[model samples]
Target: MLFDCIPSHEIPELLHCDWLQSCDDEATVLGLLDIFTSLALESSAPDNSRPGVLAALIKHARVLAEYVQRCGPDAVTTRSFIQWILAKTVAELRMEPGFHNVGLDRWDRLVINQGESVHLPVFVPLKPSEKPSWRMFLTTSNTTQESAVKVAYRAALHTDDLSLQAMALKLLSLQLEDPREPLRTLSLLQMGMQGDIDGFLSTSLSRYLLVEHLSDARSLVQELSDLDNLSGGQSLLYSGVNPCLLWARDVILGHLLAVISGQKRAGNREWERNSSLHRFEFQT
Candidate 1:
């Protein structure tokens, strides 16, 4: 058995070695991947044991993925392992809120006065058919406070699907726990508004827009409060006019109106051109 070959103490080191080759079979490699995944899940049995064990399991899965890619006996197994790695990584990251610390990139520079002066690498946007798992993996480092921006930028580089990119941008807006970037947030909202993007309101998006669109959000909140008073909380037929959603609609409408009124944003020639009222109406 694979266990007989590796002791518990050596498991950490096993992650760094090409040990999967010892299995000498694709089925065995896949079996080990499954067992490791199960073990990773089992680590969540207790809340206290979660962080360290879960981190280790993610690392282990990554290493196993590498091993399979390099040493798997067949192409099918290698491809399957690659897909599994992507899906498993995404699932774990989504489920384990605490695991946000995983996949963060290390910040190597020091910024005394941070702004646009900071030098950052820019990657080309990916095609719609492409999988951005690797770029997403690279964006996981939290060493810098701008990790959310890094992730958002990666998603922005994706021009293939408006809805998925919008979702990623929404998640980025939510994950930013520090000082907010209104420009970035507004740009994401505008992207979603101008395209075929449609989804429920994101709390982060609603909150940020509420703060920015103070008067609008406030009026909507007051209106909803009035509705609640009138119906005594029995109004289930407002037809999606909840406070959060109303805020999102107001924000999108405000931007769309701005574009229509020929309020051209500086250096946004493409946006101005693409955001014609006809195009906007068609998309809406």
Candidate 2:
């Protein structure tokens, strides 16, 4: 986001020290903070694209991080601005805690959320000189056994579990948009939940969530539908979410799409229909 410009360059006091130091007042300090924040946002918005924008944003973030770490919490005005931007960035990126699993591998990537510089343990080594060490880094994001079971179920579906293909296909038959098909998918899901089929159900959904394999999710949905265990697809539709989850998939999906496309873009200019889903506007 800041391009190749160094933060050392931000030390504007040396040569032109008199310009600002001549009027070293609280107002001047606050004004400098505002400029820095805006410059960060501006420096990071490249071609209005993803990689470009993310890079810029990260650059700006580093600058803010330096200031915050140096001044501590006393820099409330600057800190406040940083916090505001952080929140905006998180919402824009769907980076809410538990919305999706933040991988241990990608943990170090500085993701801005809620104006706080999420001081993650940067995972990837960008330069050869800056290699990441082998000191096993630990994370604390996995949910409870019951929650983990659901996570696994989503995962299996996301990855196309071989054993459940036929079941899923059969289930799909029940959701043919036909007038005669009763809401049986819910029942089948409940059956799986109740019976020893917990492994199948849990792994399937887990796979779907972990890997984002929608086909597997669909197959699982179909599996449930065929067996008449499902009452509706609404729950299946939001498989990775519930009222309890802090963030919704709808918002996360939008954030991901924007991240991929290189902007907070809302619609596909080329494909008009896909454009509708480009916007991640949702009520939590």
Candidate 3:
């Protein structure tokens, strides 16, 4: 049904073609996603376009996202079959122009997880001097106090530069050192964060604490377990920039300290005063 809408030539190449099953390169995948998304939209037009391709591409995209994220690809060759399909989609299709590669952001993450930043080059045409990308290489794997502390300070201890990541990590480590309170660190970090949109804050923090870093991360549990006089807003605000906000060498020293020492939770939403730390409800 998807083929009926396209110019005669475009249909056979895409349909008769097992294009979706054949890609393994990053660029090819982006090219394919863009090409397929376009084809799907075109084919779905009221006049003659096949609506099926739109559904098909969305399906392909999910599969593509999985393949990129969890691929078992061998080194020195195709990383994913998705890459091959992409190459097929692009090489032969009559495609709409100007589709900038949005999928690159998705794939670049895959590259980062594998400790491989090289894949970034294929998606964006980078300058020759761009340093090989790196992320917070860490201390250990579990949530043992030591590991938790490591997770909090993961970025500052590792990478260079005052990237938002460093600001966050530095603040969190300060928390570790000052478990009695986080106000000073919060004050320091607040000054550094310019126009604090949620995306910018979340992304900066996330890039530093990636899923890989968290391991068995239940941050909400941690936060609920140990909040103090400063207000959850202050605690989370500080943590957003760095893990050291409660600088406990482990949960017991830092967290238990907070549990026993935490200021009384006010009758109402006092913590919600700061927009950043107060949004997620504390559903006790």
Candidate 4:
């Protein structure tokens, strides 16, 4: 029914092929998602032209979102897939000649909802340099707090640069639990510089403490989170610029002592907490 109004020449064979119907394995599902996302993003029409094409794009995005929601976190590839869908949607919305925004907001909601449904962190792209280091914080399996804390501390100390130190501190904060609230506060201040939106947003602070940061960053964070349109040249959040806003050289001693003390919360609103940190209202 989706293709009924669209011209046959503009449609990809994958849309009509039987291959998608038999999607049973994660690989197949990923392939289909890739195809759908590609079609939605790559094939474009002007705002007033080809209404059916835009409709089809929206439909593909919804289907992909629903399928990814059901995949759960155990599906490793789903993380990247969801991020791609989100990035693609955002890209389309940014284009001046692309389809209208009429139906695209739903796709944004769908991808964000899918991310929340499966406890996947909102997948903001990290810079090339930050990716390997960020991955270091992620364990193949859950590691103990003591170990995680130690790893985070080492990461913090690994670099002398303030931004890098701030990034390490952000990673370290995730490992710290309770009582270390003072350190967390200091770390927040360290990362508070106005220039580093992506680094700040990419951290757990934004995902884990969304409401607090929303209040802290004021409308800036909310606007960044909204992704309505790209008035700026390009988004730091998506364009891959990483700089830690919190963490400094002078406070290593204090951080070490405070770290010896102990660090964490879920927040309100769908956008505000990490889904894993708190059970979403829909889950319970």
Question: What is the C-alpha lDDT profile of model 1 across 1-284, one tens digit per residue?
Answer: 67577655356446435555465465665666655654554453322234555566556666566667676346323333533433243334445445332332232111111112111111111111111222221223232323433443454444343433443454344344422453245444543454211122222223322333446435434433343343456642354333323333333344433434445432333233433421322111
Q: Write one digit per residue (lDDT tens) for candidate 2, span 74-177.
A: 45324334332432342233322332332435432211121222211122121112222212221222233223323333443554443232233222221222
The prediction achieving the highest TM-score against the true structure is 1
Which one is best on lDDT? 1
Query: Candidate 2's error at 238, in angstroms?
Result: 32
For model 2, the superposed segments whose C-alpha errors exceed 4 Å read: 1-19, 45-74, 77-284
Which stretch of 10 consecutive residues in model 3 shows the poorest summed lDDT?
Answer: 116-125
- Tell me which of candidates 2 and 3 scores higher on TM-score: 2
lDDT of 3 by residue, 1-284 (tens): 76567765445346424664575576655455555544443343322234344445545654554555453443112322322232222222213222122333422121111111001111111111121221321111222432333333333324322232333333233224222123233323433444322223322232222212232134423432444333445654454532222221122222223333443222222222321333332111
Model 2, residue 182: distance off in Å is: 36
lDDT of each: 0.38, 0.33, 0.32, 0.36
| C-alpha RMSD between model 2 and the true structure | 20.1
Clashes of each: 7, 55, 27, 8
- Residue 31 error for model 1, in Å? 16
Per-prediction CA RMSD (Å): 17.1, 20.1, 19.1, 18.3
**Would you list the rank order by TM-score, best first?**
1, 4, 2, 3
The number of residue pairs in model 4 that clash at the backbone is 8
The digit string of per-residue lDDT tens for model 4 on 1-284 reads: 88778675446444635566665566676676666655544343322244455456556556655666687854423433533433243233334332222433322221122111111123221111111122222212124433433443344344333433343343334333332353344335454543444434333333332222224334433433443232276643245433121111111112222223331111122223233333333210
TM per candidate comes to: 0.29, 0.22, 0.21, 0.28
